[model samples]
Target chain A: MERPAYRARVERILEHSADTRSLFLRTVTGRMPFYSPGMFISVKIPLPEELRIRPYTIATSPEDGEPFELIFNLVPNGRGAAWMFERKVGDLLDFTGPFGAFTLERAPDRETVFIAEGTAVAPIRPMLRRALSQPCSHSVHFIYAAAKPERLLYRAEFESLAVTNSRFRFEPLIVQGKELYESLSDEVARRWVHGDGERRRDFFLCGIGSGVLKLRDLLRGAGYERRAIHYERW
Target chain B: MARIRVIYENGSPERTIEFDPAAAPFQHDGQPGSVLDVLLGHGIHLEHACGGNCACTTCHVIVKQGINSLSEATEQEEDMLDRAPGLTPTSRLGCQAVIEDADADIVIVVPRYTINQVSESR
Candidate 1:
């Protein structure tokens, strides 16, 4: 069952914000490969010297097949981002995977908290979808933090889910002006992360390397066990 | 193609196996087929929370023997090892440790405990 490399074609591209875009890729085989939430795929883009492989988290759920989705922010000097930006519809792409251990744990009947920063929301989106679809009694709290309100991806989708799903709550933290550090600190304090009675809580974090690590330290200091904190950082 | 001998020391009733490089990039369980892939291919379920993508350190193993036979650790791998629980000079991520020497065999020691809650649950 070794995951094999597949040829995919770019089906469409949608601009989510000023700098964020979502690429939809459909396998040339006319079928979607098996993948789980939080898992990522390594896309191979040809460069002058050699092929550059970049890992991108699958944005849409597994059931949303055919054209798999990947959301990314345009990094100024990133080779992958630059190549991706130049891709047009029907362009061929080579990739391998459906890898990573960032999938949701089968912990039913417990509180689940997801803290996503910017495009880190890609992995958390599928997990939230799975959580809502399952027959679990767990409550979910998703806090999305972005540098600015415009940088927040999937804000409307999460907000709509919160309105319809009683067990779900969505909060957006926009760090504008001088309120960057204080906002995150205050929001974490306000959230009831601890579970009641014998039930346990799980926290999933995704974001840039430093931010994810900082939040992990903060959560650890807040009496959360190391095992309960799951993270994926880029 | 190289030859790799794997010793599973910490599983239920220890076991050992050999891997042929020709059969390498061994596909099992829909993984990318690394040492973690080879081990899991034979029913040895190591804790690989990152699905052998080297994103996490859960699949770390100590190369008790044949360290020189493996590929050199990348800077990213070294950085991740800093986060792993046990500190050993020979420690390597199972997913990233690819056997490169044809004449050498490898012996691996799976850590007694891994801290990934999701993998532990699985």
Candidate 2:
């Protein structure tokens, strides 16, 4: 079936950094369809000439209930970002989905590693939460990378989760002077590689196109199963 | 029913399948009766990173024949198509290009490499 477009009202906007913001949206009419962590929603922006559609990852967990959230960076000259920037509290917007197949495992069957850069952490956050909530013996790790400290979205939230959850570990990779790929390789080696062979691992990576590609290649080169490494890139 | 021929980039032999637009919505990934729908419904692997929302270009496919039989590309689809690798005059996002003429045969070429290789994890 074609995904139905649902109307939602912007309830609030939380400024995360100079370039990043989170929009909390509540369904205005019909109920928002059930969604998992990695699924995203495509927003409808009606320009004078034509309608423009852009998809944004839902940042909040389904376990959190109503007013699901979307985290995004304001791209210069980006039509979708511009339209989103123009939205205000109580303004209604039309969207479709809760779509995409980048969802998490039905049950925690192995150690989970979430690697993200910049606003890509939006989807990883909910996935991390859901992974932690389930009763599993394996540990979960999150390696978040950004060019600067300010760009590490949801740092506090992740840190808090790491502290409260015994099985969770959070690491921040700041790519200032080093190559992102090299730094990621070093980090992945230190955290995951050279580890116990008995531990089966699954990786979820999201970021700019190049970074995600590099990380995925690094993992695949290390002998991880192709299906074990799941990713989404923009 | 129409015959749909799919050409692969990895030197795999081309294959054709019967597609009936009336048996639309074979899956929920893209527009009903779309080339993506028909191909994926028949077990063809097409990478759709944005769940066929026209948000990503991983599903890019070149129309080799019967382009006129497919729906015209929308402005949003055109914008995304601009970023696809190995783009051509006939390039179209498989998810957005619905099969409008059921009886007319269609042919599409799947590129060797997409911008994103790791498709969605089911």
Chain A TM value for model 1: 0.90
Number of the top lDDT candidate? 2
Worst 10 residues of 1 chain A by lDDT: A190-199
Tens digits of per-residue lDDT, candidate 2, A1-234, equal 123568999999999876789899999878877777877887887777556556899999888877999988889777778788888899999986666546673646788888888888888988988898777788888999888999988789999998988889899989988977678878886656665443368998887756666777777777887677777766
Regions more than 4 Å wrong, model 1: A1-3, A105-107, A179-182, A192-199, B1-62, B65-90, B94-122
CAPRI-style grade of the A/B interface in model 2: incorrect
Model 1 lDDT per residue over A144-185, tens place = 888888888878999999998988989898787754435665
Return the clash pairs for model 1, or none. A1-B27, A1-B28, A1-B30, A2-B27, A2-B28, A101-B49, A101-B50
* Per-model TM values vs. the true structure: 0.68, 0.69
Q: Evaluate every candidate with DockQ and list the scores.
A: 0.12, 0.09
The residue-level lDDT of candidate 1 at A146 comes to 81
True contacts kept of 2: 0.07
* Fnat of each candidate: 0.15, 0.07
What tens digits encode model 2's per-residue C-alpha lDDT throughout B1-122? Answer: 88799998878888899978888998766789888888888988676656676656768999999999999997557656766769899999999999988796988898886644322112
